[model samples]
Target: MNPKKLKVLSLVLASLLFISCDKPEKPAEKKIELPKPASMLTLVPDDTIFFAGGLEPVPLKEWTQWSITHFNLSKEMFNPQEIQKLREEAKTDGQRLALQIWEDYLATLLALDTQFASWGFAEKPQLASYAIGLAPVLLRINLQDVQRFNTKIAELEEKAKVKAKVETLGTATFRRYALNEQEPLAHLIIGVDGNDAVFMIDVGIESQQTLALALGQSKPEKSLAQGNRLKSLQENYKLLASSLVYLDHQQILTGLTTKDGNRMAKMVQQLASKLKEENKGWLNELHSEGCRKDLQTMGANWPQTVFGYTAFDVKAKPSKVDALMVVESKDKPLLEGLKSLRGFVPYYSKEAVFAPAVFSFGLGLSVENVGPFLMKQWTEITQKQYSCSFLKEMQTDLQAKNPAAVGFATSMASGVRGLSLSLLSLSLEKKEGMATPMPKELEAVVSLSAKDPAALVQTVAAMVPQLATLQIPADGTPVQLPLPMPLPFTPMAAINGSHLTVYAGAKAEQLAKEMGKMSLESSQGFLASSLDYGKYYGLIGDVVASVDKKEGQQQATPQMLSMFEAMKQAKVRVQTKLDFTERGLEMTMDMTSPE
Candidate 1:
């Protein structure tokens, strides 16, 4: 062997060693990107609109009292000397006198407070207050002069009736006059003496035809009728008298017209406008100044106009309300306004007759028991069937925050038994709209020791696969394996509510035969264990299937069969043993075989 040849061989060996020592480089993992979630908004209604004080209507008595106290009535009372003195007074003083007279006259009521009380009037205070409060601006002319003119007109009307044959026309004939004398001074004459006579009566004999035309049946002439004594007398005498009265009354009632009333009305309208403007400005300031700061001082969110009409009623219990209001808004903007308002949560539950789904949502923290609470508060709120997914999600979120904390034993029992036990024992009905069917093959029971029983059950159900995963043991005799244990045992099927029976006659023989075919002792042992596992698994499946199939049939049957007979006997014996003192002892038994 040459030295060069040895060195070459050594180099080849070292190269092989180096190659074995190095590890392969791995590729980098790609990152997975999840889709962005949808934007969500929870809009609530304003609470102030429902509960605020100022939004309510003012009480009648309060309004009346306020009006009376604000106006000094004694100072406003009329004095005949004041009018004469007013002329000599300065312009400002005269104006003050005029205003005072106006106020006093307007405040004067034909009826007294005692009369109002006798009538059993409830809104008397409100009516009187409104009239008095508005009197100063409402009455501007002298009412005394107007009243005097009216009195004189009544006197002349009585005198004319006695002097002439007065026949009235149309509905005006039904109208009565306050004549100074009840009876005529002369002999009464009643007759339709042709067209000229009818025209005379229509003109009220000594009445001003200018004013009488409005009352007359025919078109009135601007000039006096010739040879018609009544028309001529009215033009010369009645016209002048009636005109004076008309002028006086018109001057006093001028304040009642649209022009005069509108001035005061404008002030009120301006006040309302200013209030709204101030509210808007405050809202803008709140937005800019940070809502938290405003909320701290205000205690809650501000009221805003919302959907439909908003009405407020503020009253202490056992007493009449102080104020009441009715606010109306229109269209979808009203709904938007309601949503923009704050301090209230909104919930909507919808049910569809034929659609594939329905939807519902909650806007705030809610209790599991809130469904009944809301319904109790507002009977109009109705229960509705919604999409199962929607309800499940809502329940999930709610339960996470406020889990239904069940005792350990109760939770364990519920979990092991699964929904079946819950359905049977608690009589919980299957909720409508649930798309997922409960896993029939795998039943679990959790011990009551678990924390948050409802959540634990739900968590386990969600985590575990419904299908069973089989694992073979390495050591065992060729005996039947029991079924995989259900978390909660069915007491009726279980042997003393602990162990499960696995093999029947034929299945037992078959399992033993399969175990005999294994070669090595280890293989033989593994085969035996596998047989037991298989047998237990098969038995569990059979028992579950039998229970599922027979439960409904047995429930429907009315016959007193062997199983039922045994149950009845047991019940009697148990009752007799306990002396019938026990309450809520329930037992259910089911038996089934394959067809």
Candidate 2:
């Protein structure tokens, strides 16, 4: 590997290990009131294009230890013995340097004296200037004891056979590492200011200004803390957020489009012109007045999107994490329009979601009034006669598809409220000794909800003319569907006033019948899913066995076999739920792995 690539890899590995893992909190050697993680937002420039905030403060020493332990626990998957042997056989300076860099940096990070670390990023931009533009980007890591941190950096520099050049900007002093001595297109800038370890790539001449903004020597006219946009989101989600991300689409688009003589903008304009000359005029629509207005309207309608973790519990009996993302829009008409599209899928209560299955998924799709909604949107756009060529083309395409939407609305969409699919059971038959086991059973169900059972049956009948001959009951009763071809298992379908279900395999019909009484409570979201990992592991093993039995197929490797053995002894289950509120949509997932 190139030394530069090794250097980048070392930094990335150290960062990932340092920030993502955790262990039990230890008592601080000396009591101190660490600032709230959100306080880091005060340093961010208000015009930031994108920002990701790590609001949880983690004890660096404990975190590094935990990460190492977790990696060790999963080392079999990587076959560590092989990796170590390969390291021992390394001959080149770069290869030896790579292994040394990993060890030296890992040790340095693990021994850090810092009690807790919090990080933040502002103004998302290219980290290196392999591009034509420069945008303000800043990365800050909250630190204590700058001397200890610098000492660690010194050790890394020595091991990597690279040198750091100490330099200053305004009142801030930083260490700069050139990408290469001959052609230093980008420089990695690392510095300490007050409590932050500021990092940014010096991509251009304006980098000093960017670094100054990061170091607080130069301040934004209005900092993100002053904006208080996250406050409402925090309150709305009721999360003591471990992390939050904010993207101002409007600000980002305006910056990209409105800037005069912007290199990127000019390049795009050139491309559009070339395309227009070839009679592909849609690209030109981007620079059109109508498109600009439409974009502005779009940005205004949904000015920003935010994401935050509502609940996070990694130290529990079974670690769990829950996060929420919201697309904020205050436009009454837009919000009302989305509300009308909310499907009738019911809430997936614990009891309602659980079934005899390895994996199950259910989705709520809007069925009612879709035709009229599409027609209304079409009318508005057509009546306005959008001048943008792209919009005109899209309108033409939608007009062609409008009849299909109308057909869907009148037949199936107007009647069905929700859909559910479940993998009921899967297993391998017992085999003695070395003989490969055969598939014993597999079953699944597909179901939908509706107010009128007969309507659902009629809809299916219209699609499959053969179904019209069966004397299907409106009451919940299973009816076998005739297959045009031979199959190993029987397939049956049933319809009730509330649900229509199709079952594959013999026992699946019972599950279909039960669907008649199953609650159709609103899930309050578009989709939800659950997985039983213990069962999933068994399924995977059976699949691997079957594949291995195939002629000319290679048997499972020892490492892969060992991994499956480990998985068999572990119990894990995951459930996810999503919901849309007046503000935006929020999805949460919970994973349980009890000892």
Candidate 3:
């Protein structure tokens, strides 16, 4: 009675089974584990005000290759023919030995292909009360091969005939090179612990506790690596950085001003007292309690700064870098004031940045409010009536000059919002054997933007009466400016609804016209710059040639010539920008070279 029904149900179940088999189980997501700061950071004391560490390992060859290229030390320099020529040309034994050592070092770099391990610097406590002296420093870097490094060092020492004195502190032994015979604290000390090399500068045996602390025999009560600050930084910048830098601005200011619980502060007080005894009234102003409080107030604006690389692509056709720097601040008014400084950047500004040029820079500023902002700051300083003697004087002067400052800030010229400076083109004359090669072709432009272009031109014209007579148009039209003195290139000016541009060179009028038509608004940022190294070096070479000729020389020195040759091979380009974001003021730089 149900045969048909049973067959239909079986067919439906078969189809469901086939669908389930085709659909695979959802794969589990994999979490990425981020790298941490250098292990040696754990030994750094909590009192350390500044620290910088690398999270990713960098090959030693990277540094060597850069040095080789920058110094024009090519493979040919190490070849047998060049080596013989260099030796024969050496004027002294010192020169010959130095050349040989550099060649040996380069050869060694080829054989040793090891990479650098984690490294960091931790500021050490100073033991003196002098107003000026080298600050104590401690740095630790791990060696990939201690034996090979030590062997190379030994060879260098033997060749130079200058030996470092061996000294011991507890169980740790170090090689010390005295930088100054009269100063006990001025020495470069290097100690090896396993694969880690501990370096100390301006530290003496008198600082036994410091020596022990640096050697890691005595553990600090609190360490940077074990702290939540570094942990938080690592977590926030996870996978985005190969290195990180931390600065404690508040701690530094406090340590300098506080009289209690800080040896450096105490030393500062003692120095201040000695200066007072010598009748140094100017230096004594800083030692007063009023100055300390003023300094503390200023320091509260920015307590700390953190920096790291967001992108580092060295393997690209041209290497690129993007970094982020954060100033940890909670003062809302101060932040708002700083943020207000950024103005409307037009799209043409970016065109100017990327356009082929020796050098170019663009800066954006909120022109409308800058005058009021500056006036407000000056008023605050004067109204505060600071008790510090030096500050009191400043306050008095500002109170007297505030009226004039207000007038200047509120002037029509202050309405300008953006500025761009560029050296568009440059070339030397082609005349053979000329003593001074005059610029045959040169172009430069300075473009300005304003809230009221007509008002700005009127204000400028009032100052330069000659400009008033021309009656410059407001329809983005270019007008040649009359000058009392002759110029190498024609001076041109143009004004649109928002932009006022000035130009000099053969193409000044054309560039001004193009600038007038620029209508696209630029992306938000305060500053941007671009440079072409190949063009820059070419200009520099011409200058050097001119200078040599003026000094009665026919050609530039060999070193200068070699540098020009190397620069031609690299053909590097660089661009940079500065902007404000939720993360804080961010600056990015990109550097690339041709393959």
Return the top candidate by TM-score.
3
**Tens digits of per-residue lDDT for model 1 on 1-595?**
2343223223322322221111111121223121111100000011101111111111322323322232212222334454445333313221232233232223332123432122222221101000111111010011112233333323433433322233455533312221112121111111121111110111112233311332333332221122232233224222211010001111122212222232222222333344556564532332232332323222222122111111111122211111111122222332332322111111111111111011111121112223333333232212322223333354455444422242322333331210101011111122245332233322211111111233443454466655123222222222222345642223121111111112223322232233223221111000000011122333333333333224345321222222232222211000000000011111111111111
TM-score of 3: 0.72
TM-score of each: 0.15, 0.71, 0.72
lDDT, model 2, position 324: 61
| Higher-ranked by lDDT: 2 or 3 | 2
Per-candidate Cα lDDT values, in order, are 0.22, 0.56, 0.56
The clash numbers for all candidates, in the given order, read: 22, 7, 2
- Span of 10 residues, lowest total lDDT, candidate 1: 572-581
The better candidate by TM-score, 2 or 3, is 3
Given candidate 3, what's the lDDT at residue 50? Answer: 65
**Predicted candidate 2 versus true structure: per-residue lDDT over 7-79, tens digit per residue:** 4434443443234322222223334445555466666666666665544453444434433332223333445
Clashing pairs in 2: 345-523, 346-521, 346-522, 346-523, 347-521, 347-522, 347-523
Q: Which candidate is the best by lDDT?
A: 2
The collision pairs in model 3 are 346-522, 347-522
Q: Mark the regions of model 3 whose C-alpha exceeds 4 Å error after superposition.
A: 1-38, 63-138, 159-161, 181-184, 234-240, 259-291, 326-329, 344-354, 385-403, 430-435, 465-473, 477-493, 503-521, 551-556, 579-586
Candidate 2, residue 76: lDDT: 38
